[model samples]
Target: MPGIEAGGIAVVLVARSAIAAAPRAEMERLAGQVSGLHEIALATYAFTEQGQPALREVVANLRRRPFREIRLVPLLFPMEASFRAWIGRTLARWQLEWDTEGPAIRIGPGPNASERLTDLVSDLVETAGREKPFMPAEHPATTGSVVAAAHRRVLVCQGGPCNEAGAAAIWGHLRNEQEGQSLRTAGSGMMSATTSCLGPCSLAPVVQVWPEGTVYGGVNEAGIDAIIREHLLGDRPVESLAYPANGRKQALRLRE
Candidate 1:
C-alpha cells in the first residue's frame, strides 16, 4: 500500500510459457533494488501451457493491488505475430471487464533477443568447452524425407481459448486421422502440428491450414472427418466453418 501513490507505475512481465518462473523471480528480485519510485511491483504471466500465473490470473491479482499505472512487458524474443494479437485481445478484454479509472494499463514492446540473447548464447557456448560438434552418432535422414513429402500442413491452436473449448479431443482426433491415412507415396502426405493462441479467442478450437492460410472455427470431433476428407485430401476450404480474415465474429454452427 506504500507504493499506491497517484503517479506510481507497476511493471508486469509477461512470459511465453510456464517454465519462466525462475526468470520472473529473478526479475522481481532485481526490481526491488531500483530507487526513487512511489511503489513498484513485478508480476509475471505466461501465454501457453507449462507456466503458472497466467495472464488472466496476474491481471486479476494486479487489480487488487495499489497502483496508479500498469506497464506490461513481454518476455518473448522477437515477438511473434500470434503473440502480439493475443496480447492485444487480452488487454482489450481486461479494459472491458474491470474499472479503468484505478490504473492506466499500457503494454510495452517485447524484448529484442537478436543481440543480447545471441551474446548470452555465445557466452554459454564458450563456458561449456566446445567439443567435436553438437550432434548424435546416428541421424535419421528419413524423418526429413517424410516431412518434405507432405502436401498439406494443418496447425491446430492449442492456446488458452481452444484448450477451454475442448481442443484436446480435437487434437487427438486429428492425430488419429493422420495416422489412419495411407502415406504410401510422396504426393499423398498430410502433417499436423499444434501451435499457441491464434488470436481468435471467441472462435475456440480453431484450425489453420497452409499454404492457403484458411482458418476454421468451432471445430469438433464430428467436423474432423469432414475437414480431413474435404480440406486436407480434397483440396477445398470448408467455407461454412471458416473464420473471417478480418477477425469479425460470426455465427458458429458446430455439430452436437
Candidate 2:
C-alpha cells in the first residue's frame, strides 16, 4: 500500500501475544523514522481469547484521536481462517457502532511466514544475545538476581472470550500467587506472563505452563491456587483442569 498523507492516516500493528512487546517497540521505532504517517500504534489481540487493546478497543481509541484513516496491519505469520473471521467481525462491529464520518478503516495482510520475518527474528535473537544481560530487579548483590530464562514461564490467556469468561480475575489470582510464592526470589525459578489468546475460545480463561506445554482451561480463582501449588511449585500438572491435547473436551471443573 502507498504511504498515507502526513496527518490523515494512522498505522496500527496488530500482533499476537507471545512476541508482541519487542516487535511492537521495534515497529514503532522504525515507523517514527518514516515521514507522512500520522501516528503508528500497536494493538495486540488473540485469535481465540481476549487480548489487551483488542481491535474494538483500538478502534475506539483511534476514534478519539485526530486521524481520519486507520490502517490495521496484522503481524501474524499466516493469515489463518480464524484470524480472517475475527478481523471481519471486528470491522463489522466498528461499522455498526461508528458513523460514516469516523476514521476510514483498512486491514492489511499478515507477514505470511516469509523468509524476511524469519531473518528478522534471527536478527532480534542475535541482537538481544549481544546486548546487556537481563537484571530481573534492582538488587544490592548481583549473584542473587533472578534471570527470567531460568524460570518456568506461565502464560495466562486474556483474550476476548476469556476476558468475558472472567479471565481477568483468574489472571489476578495467578499474579497474586506468583508473588506469594516468591518465585522471583533468586533460585525460585518461576515467572508468569499474561497472553492475549491461546486459540481455544470454547475453553476460555486458559492458562498454559511452558516447557511442559500443559494448558489448563476454564480456570477460575480457586483453580489458580491448585495450579500454583501443583504445577508451578511441585512441577506436577493438575490433570483435572488440564486441556486435553487431542482436542477432546473435558468436563468444566473450575468454579465460575
Candidate 3:
C-alpha cells in the first residue's frame, strides 16, 4: 500500500466484470502508484448476468466507512455514450434515493484509450508475432449451445424502465441468491435470464417465474428475499407480492 495517499480517500477503479467483482494484483498496485489515493478498489458500471460487483454497492459500503471522499475511476473505455451517461445518472440517483448523506462522491476521468492503450496494444501485437497464442480447446464452439435441463426459469427484466430502476442489481442479486442457495441448473434446476419486459410497467420493476408465469411486482433487494424463500425455494409463492393477487399457477412445471 506504499505511495498511496494516507487520508480517508477511496479510489474506485471501474474495471471489467471479474476484476471489479474482486479487485486485486496489478490493477490495485497501479492505482496506488499512479493516483496515490488513500484507498483503491474496483467496481463495475453495472451488474451482470453472473451477478458481479456493482458500483452502487461499492460506493454504499465506502460511504459507511470513514472516508471523506470517494473517487470512481472507470477502467472500461470505448463504450456507448449512453452507457457512460447512465453511470453518471445512476450515481446521482443513488445520492437522492439513499436517506443518509455521507462522504462526497466524485467521478475521475476515465483512461484515454488511444493515448493510454495504443502502446500496450502495439506491444501485444509485436509480442504475439514471436510468442504463440493460447491453444484453442478441443471441444467444438457449439459445445455449449444445447439448452439447459432446468425445472424453473427466472426472468429479471433489464431493458426499458427496469434498467433505470436498478434492475441490473436486482438481476445480479437474484442470480447470486440462486447460486448461494444451491439452486442451480444441476441442483434445484433454476435458470435465470435477463429479459426486455414482463408487462405491468406501472409495477415499474418486476420479476417473473417461468412456466407458472408468476410475476412479482414492486420488487427490491429486500423483496427478493421473500420471493426466494417462498416461491423459488419453497412450495408457495410470496402471496403479498403476487402481481395480480391470483396469477400463480398451481404447481411448478419442469422439463428434463
The candidate scoring highest on lDDT is: 1
Clash totals for all candidate models: 2, 6, 0
For model 3, give the 10-residue run with minimal summed lDDT: 247-256
Give me the runs in candidate 1 sitting further than 4 Å from their true place. Answer: 1-6, 19-50, 113-256
Q: Give the per-residue Cα lDDT of candidate 3 at 208.
A: 89
Q: What are the per-residue Cα lDDT tens digits for candidate 1 across 1-256?
A: 4644435677766655434457656655544543234356443443332244445556666666667777777766667656656556645645565655456678776766345777876798997876665886585566533346677778889898777665644665566556546522323466778999987778887998888888889886556777777877777888778876875666566553
Per-model lDDT: 0.65, 0.64, 0.64
User: Please, what's the RMSD in Å of model 1?
Assistant: 11.2
Per-model TM values vs. the true structure: 0.46, 0.41, 0.68
Clashing pairs in 2: 49-159, 49-160, 50-158, 50-159, 50-160, 51-159
In terms of TM-score, how similar is model 3 to the real structure? Answer: 0.68
lDDT digits (tens) for residues 1-256 of candidate 2: 3243334666666654323476546655654554343354322232122234344556666667656677777766656645655555546644664654566778776776465888888899999999997777665665665446545778888787766665654665565555555765434377778888888778777889888888888775567788877777777899888877776655556442
Collision pairs in model 3: none
Residue 196 local lDDT, model 1: 94
Span of 10 residues, lowest total lDDT, candidate 1? 42-51
